[model samples]
Target: MKEKAEKNKLLIGIILVLCIVILGGVIYFMKQKDQNPDSAFKPDLDSNAAAMEQGDGEDEPDGIRIPGYPSITIDADTTDVKMNLMNPEGNPCYFTFEIILSDTNETIYTSKMVEPGKAITNVTLKHGLEAGEYPAVIRITTASLEDGSAMNGANVETTLVVQQQ
Candidate 1:
């Protein structure tokens, strides 16, 4: 009985050592990733989108499409809009957004240097728009996470049906 207990104690000790070693390795890797933001290789967004286009000759997304940005919203003379941005991958990304009025091909809003994982709640639009259906487009450009090169761009077309409150 004594010998059996001793063997069990040794086994437990070995397991504890292994656990500690694993924990240390995990911490070390996380630190390394933080220190070297460009260590991971992210596929070029343009290449990926181009490949998809060539595959079936169909339009596909390049950067990760953010949710909650409805294709359409009624401005109703609202002053500001809440735009959101996010970086789905582990790398940081720079974004450029523009709002264009399709009727006149006028760029109503233009914003550059948006960061990752953020919501732009202070976006404002010109009020007193004539009550009617207006077609607008939002163009988004994603730059390289490492070097801020032009990676990919896409457009989100939406219609605003302005009505008096």
Candidate 2:
């Protein structure tokens, strides 16, 4: 009887030790996870914005006159869309308008480079998109210098929700 009791006590001790080990491991892992909450997910707001603004500027035959990003939106039917061109630079500039689809980064429409100070009317979209919400980013770039380098460039981003008709 004494030997049997001793054996039972030893088994219980081993089991307790194992339970403590498992519990400590669990606690340590939980603390580590708490320390790194972003391990599972991360977001790149800047890149996403850039992608949405596919047509940043229009490259003119003479030079590139990119317009600064402004408040732009697309209608649900994927038909009507408008963007206000804002020129932050004190000097007047021109813009080549282009429409890029958010989903596939596709260039749907483009316009001839329009000089600054002259406002452009509604620019139609070329490729019709399916019903879904999307981001419509407008890119503005200036003409490259004689060195064949792009000059002033800026990105203006906005969200567009396209619904079915």
Candidate 3:
């Protein structure tokens, strides 16, 4: 009887240690996944801007099809939009930027021929738009590339809401 009790105590101790090890491994894996950009994790503005240049070629357009750009979200009171434009396709192309709100079309900004590869541009609006949901459209024209360049233009419409602070 004494020998059986001692063996039982030893088994319980080993089990507890195993559980602790498993728990630690799980926590470490969760942290690592959060740091991965490809995951559903959205980093701060600086990291997010860097990821804009990367994409999944599986969804990329073929033969001049415009790839959809990510949507933008901004606070209504934000007067200036800090943004970076990326040329994923390794070829030079032309692009036009516009905004449409409530059926009214207006040219908020434009980019003259973005050079091949990544071309980061900062566009400042002349006037701050009213706080509301608007359709952000980017029309890309590739007059040079033979395969039309795998250009995924802006597909995201920004929802600008002004919050009273």
- Let me know the TM-score candidate 1 reaches against the reference structure: 0.51
lDDT of 1 by residue, 1-165 (tens): 999999999999999999999999999999999778587545333211111111344454664554434554445667565444333333346556677888898887666555554434456665446667888887887776666677666787777667666
Query: Residue 48, candidate 2: how far off, in angstroms?
Result: 29
Which residue pairs show collisions in model 2?
53-137, 56-139, 64-143, 66-141, 76-163, 93-116, 94-116
Instruction: Evaluate model 2: give its lDDT.
Output: 0.52
lDDT (Cα atoms) of all candidates against the true structure: 0.61, 0.52, 0.52
Give a tens-digit lDDT track for model 3, residues 1-165. 999999999999999999999999999999999776567522122112232454556564544333454555544555466555554554344333444443456656555554444443455565666666566555454444432344545444553343322
Order of candidate numbers by TM-score, starting with the best: 1, 3, 2
Candidate 2: tens digits of C-alpha lDDT, residues 1-165? 999999999999999999999999999999999777566423211111111222445543443334444434456555546644433222234344455656677766655544343444455677555666567766555432222234565555655555555
lDDT top scorer: 1
User: For residue 8, what is the lDDT in candidate 3?
Assistant: 97
Q: Residue-pair clashes per candidate, as listed?
A: 0, 7, 3
Give the 10-residue window scoring lowest on summed lDDT in candidate 3.
41-50
Question: Listing every candidate in turn, what is its Cα RMSD in Å to the true structure after a full C-alpha superposition?
Answer: 13.9, 16.0, 16.2
**Model 1 misplacement above 4 A:** 1-63, 66-70, 82-92, 126-128
**Clashing residue pairs in candidate 1 (N, C-alpha, C atoms within 3 angstroms):** none
TM-score of each: 0.51, 0.43, 0.44
